[model samples]
Target: MPSDVRRTTLLTVAVLVWTLAGCRTVNRGLTEAVLDGEHARQWHIRYGSQSFYSLGDEGLAKIEFEGLIDRERVRVRYQRGMQGQAECVADVTTRLIEQVELRVGMTITTSTTIDLLRFDEPPQNFDIQLTVEPNEFPLPLFVRAGDESCTSILAQNRSYPYVLMHELVETSLAARAGGRVLPDVGYGWFGLGGSVNNYTRWFRDGLANYAGYLACEILSDEMDCPECPTRVAPLLHTSPLSRLATVRTRLFSWSQSSPSEHEREHYNAALGLFLLIEDRFGQQTIRDILADVATRETVDGRDLRAIASQVIGTDVKQFVADFEFPMIGGVLTPVTRALAANKGLNVAEGLLLEFVEPDGPADRAGLRPDDVIVAAASAPVADTIDFELALLRAGRPASIPLAIWRKDAGTIDVEFPLLYPGKD
Candidate 1:
């Protein structure tokens, strides 16, 4: 199969496992394991295995600036202690206001605040936090301090500007959605009554991610360079639709909740859902969905479904059901046969790989799709969680032995070099 289709298939099977597993804890761990593996592989490919460098006390000093957008004052701050980096951030923030204004079709009369900080370690990515007051017109957004300036992509670090644009887009959406005072129906897991809260949160989060995607796309286009080091490339490469498939399938069951760990899945799923809406119903449908969100005092699944159905002129539940479980005719399917077959394996058992990234560490080490990874680094890999723990225990720069099984080949072992030279 083509790489993209194979990736979709692997993601589908992983999500099905999460939805069908009887035990929530086990399922959560396995899902996390699968995701973490993918993240580590992606990070390694993008940034390589280079260690982080501290900017010292000088780099941690804060730089602050002010601007006016739509006649509303905006405050921007960062800790890079560099004139160019600060200027880049300020410029992006200004452009973001214009992009958001055009997309939301509003004047954005509210004042905004933005902060950018640096971290001392790795897991080098960016995230946003929005604080809103009841009945507030403008919202306060914090881009939680990260070592963004210290991280490099494609041999140079231009993440600060791109990340700033993303956070601003999210903040703009939140401001339009009634700021911080919007009612929270305890979305996610078994909160309040029924599944509406969970789906509502999903819709809200998905919209924000899509907004970020839109902002990034604008920036990417203006650059007019395919390798311009814009944030959109990585976001596109991360395969949000595949990740959303996992979130949609395991919504009520999966329990892992660290924002740093799970935000990508949430954002990716949200963007995917939004993109699907645009693809099927048109951009106007997306605007209508947001408009519905802005006018509602309380958001519930029924209300959301009604708004969506009204916009599409069809049963929204069926639409959602189709999106959530796209593989088996809008129904949850089990992988009991695969799980049952692993029972006889003497080594640890886990999800079998359907496709490994070409030239990846596993591929280079002779690991192939359909190989049941029973153990990692001599540790029992009964599931994804165990597999992740084993990988962690093995650490970087280690030759980890993977115990595998194939129908014709029987029990065999392959050694994967963690943090391989060039790949890292």
Candidate 2:
């Protein structure tokens, strides 16, 4: 009887250990599948800001647009009879790049090759997959494949043109800002000094979406090209700034837990900042910001902010603050450093009203154009950013008291009502 009991106990213990191990194995597989696959590659392209200049090794060129462009120009070689649906979007991408070339101040002036290709008959009951023919010659573009046209696959995926937009913009801007072919200067210590180029990821990804939307809107109205496909159109509406505000988490710093988490922070925050730049300055200013960013490989987060501040003529943090809280229903421009010195404000921290919408919350609350915001909620506002932070600290109240400085009337206290609900 004692021997029987011991055998039973051993069996039970063995079963429990095996069950636990099985659970762990399943979980480990799931984690690897999710993190180490296509999702992982997406992070690499955007956050890693993959360099097209150096593709000496096959490892780096295994990406979506890998080896798509040869050393020289925008040339895509497809199989014969490949002109069906694939060439449509390919044409659109080419024309869009041409327009971007004009906008970013590069004329291209080189011949572009777009060949539509389709392979011969495959085995019966077999589907022929389209792929890119590798460029051994000086051809401009090559798509990877095994007896298939990759462009056809892209057109069917519905993310074809919009995804192509950003890549083209990035490539075009980099080519023009630096040169058609940029040389690789390795970063010191595991490429650490330059790999975490927060600015590159921020600008590359944000401007991609920012400019992509505008480009799509234009093409929709004018060219009837496939800009945003039906399925993916909704994804483009995500406002980077408002999303973070809703979550109540400010941008993540470099010391955060995971690289992916930090990368997510960079994407939304950068887009928010770019939207504000477009609002305060203009579209031209955003282009100019990109022009500066494309040339520098090591411009980190702070460097980007400073460069944007110089171009937009305001402290970049103000933009950060602008999206950090609810909308104040008016556009605010930072008081220039010289003007702030004349006004005795710290770092020239003050906001000048650029435009107040008629009958909007600002207009209704007696905020006028050219009126400077000196303080909010009885707290001194060092700048537009400070004003937003003050609003956030006060819980984004419906109505907050503000001290306004008008040129002729001097300082006046007013209850500024924030009626505009933040981005949806």
- Top-lDDT structure, candidate number: 2
Write out the backbone clash pairs for model 1: 48-424, 49-424, 117-146, 118-146, 119-146, 119-147, 206-270, 349-382
Instruction: Evaluate all candidate structures by whole-model CA lDDT and list the values in order.
Output: 0.50, 0.52
lDDT of 1 by residue, 341-378 (tens): 55443333344666677766667678776667776787
Candidate 2 residue spans exceeding 4 A from truth:
1-73, 84-87, 101-155, 171-200, 222-237, 244-258, 290-303, 324-424
Question: What is the C-alpha lDDT profile of model 2 across 217-309, one tens digit per residue?
Answer: 445544543322422223443335454454322442322223564565465555555555666566688778656765666455566667778
Model 2: lDDT equals 0.52
The alpha-carbon deviation from the true structure for residue 101 of candidate 2, after best TM-score superposition, in angstroms, is 4.1
Root-mean-square deviation of each candidate, in angstroms?
A: 23.1, 18.2
TM values, all candidates: 0.45, 0.44
When summed lDDT is taken over every stretch of 10 residues in candidate 2, the lowest stretch is 134-143
Best TM-score among the predictions, by candidate number: 1
